[model samples]
Target: MLVLDLVATLVFGVSGGLTAVRLRLDVVGVLALATLTGLGGGWIRDVLIGVTPPAGLADWRYLTAPMIGGLVTFFLHPQLDRINATISVVDAFGLGLFSVAGALKAVEHGLGPLPSTLLGLTTGVGGGVLRDIVIGVIPTVLRKGELYAIPAVAGAGVAVLGSRLELTTPVVAAVAASVTTGWRLLALWRGWTAPEPVRAAAAP
Candidate 1:
């Protein structure tokens, strides 16, 4: 579980750093994005549960991970830019892992199903939201199409249900994360989308 958490943080930090490079942000912006992506979800989760200061703020390892991510990206931007698909793959994996982790942690903390699932979504999507907001764009989760938060919710739901079925925690986490990542990749490859909202008729 500790390894999974670190991997998720690294992946998210890399994704955020890549986005910052695309936006031509300065080093500060890049570092900020990496930090936010690496720490934002857990920070939010802890805060909501009344954990003061948050683990990320208190833990040097978490803080250092994103710094390393930012430095790697800063030096490798040109090479990484040539392979945007690679970044997408990493981001998808991070999303799945974080979502499952968040859901499991929430349940461990005695949260109910709905809130647990929501926390999972927030964990999966929160970093990207912060990254996009930094770059002044609406989040991809709110846009017309994208697997994004939908897969997070689905993944978390599966994990939570499995928990109730007495499945081993590791097995549930693995299955949920794998399914979410698969769904996201398939959505990207095939352009899957949810139905768009139908606007109500204008006053007439």
Candidate 2:
């Protein structure tokens, strides 16, 4: 879990730092955004699950991954800029990994399937949402016709079902992460979109 968590953190941190660089934020702001994007979801999950002090606060690695990400982006963003689309793809991978990991952890902690799944979704999107809100942008998960949160829920559901069926954690997580990442990547490739509220036609 720790390994998966840290891997997810690094990718998310890079994405966050890239965003900050694209927006021309200062060094401190870039670092701050990267840290929040890397650890915010885990912190929120830990707090809600009664893990006080949060891993983000207690673990040096959790804090350091984002810092390194920020530094890398700060120094290398000009080259990184050529591959913005690639960053989004990596962000999708992080989303998948985190959702499965979070759901499995919640289940381990005795959370019910429903709560575990919901918490998993939160864990997947919370960091990106935080990063977006801090930068005054609408969260991608909440955007109209966005295809983000549903993939998270689907991935979390797989983990929840696997747990209920007594599957091993590693196997279940692999399946769930694959489902989420594949779905997200396919959606991006095919321009698949979530539903948006329809507006009735107005009288002329």
Candidate 3:
């Protein structure tokens, strides 16, 4: 589980750095975005639980994960620049993995259904929100329409519910994550977005 967390963090960090590069940010800006996106969710979770030092600071791996991700982006900027589609694919996988991990950990800590699910959503989307804010764009979650948080909520719910049903943890997590990832990617490919309401004209 720890290894999975680290890998997902690195993946998100790389994608975040890629976003920064696309925005034409400087080196410092790029690293900053990567690190923040990598650690923001864990940091938020730790702070919420009053965990001293926060997981991001206590674990060297957490700090190093984003740095490595940033380095990857730095060195592979040219390749990544021409591969926007690749980034989206990788980002979806990262999102699903992290959502499962976050929800699982939250349940382990004794949170109930709603709170645990909320934590999962936060974990999945928090970093991306921070990354976007750093680069001066609205977070995807807050935008007109995106399937991001919806799928995360679905994945988290599945994991938590499966645990309550006494299923194996690893299997539950994997299934939930896979489902979430599949749904998100399909939505993206099909341009599935929330419908905008039609407004009535003002009374004459």
Candidate 4:
């Protein structure tokens, strides 16, 4: 679970750094965004579950992973810019990893399955939401036609269910992550979208 969380943080940091580069943000902006994207979700999860100080704040590796991502993007943005699709694919994987890890952690903290699932979804997408808001864009989770949150919810739910069933941690994590990553990738490749709300007709 620790390994999965760290890898997810690094992956999200990369995603955030790439977004900053695309926006032509300065070095500080890039680093800040990376750190927020990498650690925001976990921090939120920890705080909500009464874990003070947050693990990311306590662990040097957690802090370093985002720094590395930010520095790498700062130096290699030109090359990275050409691979937006690949980055999206990787971001999906990160989403899956975070979701399962968060759900499992919540379960360990004695949260009920439903709460664990919600926290897992939040852990998967909270950072991205913060990043988008900081950059003055609507969050993907809230945007029309974006299929971002559903897969996360599904993944978290699966992890929670697996835990309830007493499945091994590794097996639960793997299956839950696979479900999220696969669903997200398929959505991207096939242009799948969440349904939009209907607009009322205008008065003449």
Candidate 5:
């Protein structure tokens, strides 16, 4: 769980740093955004579950992961840009890992299955949502027709169900994460989207 969390943090942090670079933010902005994006979801989860101070804040490794990600993006963004497509895939992987990790933690804390699933979904998207809000943009998960949150919810549900069924944690996490990452990658490849409300034609 620790390893998975660290990897997810690094991936999300790199993504945030890349966004900062694209927006021409300074070094401080890049590092700040990276740390926020990496740790925001976990912090929110811990607080909601009544855990004091949050695990990310208490752990040096969690801080280090995002810091390294920020530095890597700061120095290597040019090379990173050439692999934008790959980064999206990796981001999906991070989303999956986070969803499972969050849901399991919630279950460990005695949250009901439904609440755990919701928390898991929140964990997957919360960091990105916060990052977007900080940068003055609408979050992708909340944007019309985006398919991001649905996959997360589905994965979280699966994780909760697995826990309820007494499945081993490793197996449950693997399956849940694969479901999320696969669904997201499929949506990206196939242009799948959530349903959008139809707009009436403009009045003449």
Candidate 6:
């Protein structure tokens, strides 16, 4: 579980660092943003689950991964920018992973299915929300045109259901995460857009 957490943190950390780089932040700012984006969701989860002092803070490795991510981006932004096309793929994979991990943890902590699903989504997107808000941009998960949260919800739902069904942990997590990552990738490839709210006609 810690390994999965660290992996997701590293992935999110890279995205956060890349955002900092895009905004021309110095190394300190980059690391700060990376730390927040990498561990924000897990922290939110731990708090909701009544676990004081989240894993990211308690476990040195969790913090270390994000710092490494920041350093990589800080020094190698040019190489990363050159391969920018793969960035979204990495981000989507992390989203799927986090969602599954979140849902499983919630279940382990005795949360019901509905709450677990929601927590899964939160764990999947909360870090990015923190990153975006800190950077003064609308969070992608809250934006209408993006299919981000939908896939996350689907993945979390699967994990929750699988847990209830007594499936093996590894199987449930892998399948659920794959569904999420696959759906998100398909949306990206196909330019799929979530439906937007229609404005009501003005009264005459």
**Per-model tally of clashing residue pairs:** 0, 0, 0, 0, 0, 0
Ten contiguous residues with the weakest lDDT in model 6: 195-204
Please estimate how well model 6 matches the true structure, expressed as its whole-model Cα lDDT.
Answer: 0.90
Q: What would the per-residue lDDT of candidate 2 be over residues 11-72, giving only the tens digit for each residue?
A: 78888898898889999888999998998888888899998898777989889988888888
Winner by lDDT between candidate 5 and candidate 3: 5
Off by over 4 Å in 5: 198-204
lDDT of candidate 3 over 147-182, digit per residue (tens):
788888899889989988989999999998987799
Instruction: In candidate 2, list every pair of residues with a backbone clash.
Output: none
The estimated TM-scores of all candidates read 0.91, 0.92, 0.89, 0.93, 0.94, 0.93
Candidate 1: lDDT of 177? 95
- The lDDT of each candidate is 0.85, 0.88, 0.83, 0.89, 0.91, 0.90
Q: Give the TM-score of candidate 5.
A: 0.94
How well does model 5 score by local distance difference test? 0.91
**TM-score attained by model 6:** 0.93
Instruction: Give candidate 2's error at residue 200 in angstroms.
Output: 5.2
Error of 4 at 103 (Å): 0.8
Model 4: residues with Cα > 4 Å off, grouped in runs: 1-4, 199-204
Q: After superposing candidate 3, which stretches have Cα over 4 Å from the reference?
A: 195-204
Q: Summarize candidate 6's per-residue lDDT along 1-204 as a digit string, tens digits.
A: 667667778878988999999999999889988998998988899999998898778989988998898899999989988877687888888899999899899999999999999999989999899999999998978987779999999999999999999999899999999999999999999989887768865776
By lDDT, the better pick of 1 and 5 is: 5
Number of clashing residue pairs, candidate 1:
0
Best by lDDT: 5
Of candidate 3, the 10-residue stretch with the lowest lDDT total is 194-203
Instruction: Please estimate how well model 1 matches the true structure, expressed as its whole-model Cα lDDT.
Output: 0.85
- lDDT tens string, model 1, 1-204? 677677778778887888888888899988899999888888888788777788888988888887788878988988877887877887788889988888887888899999999988888888788788878899878887776888889999888988878799999999999888889988888999977659865777
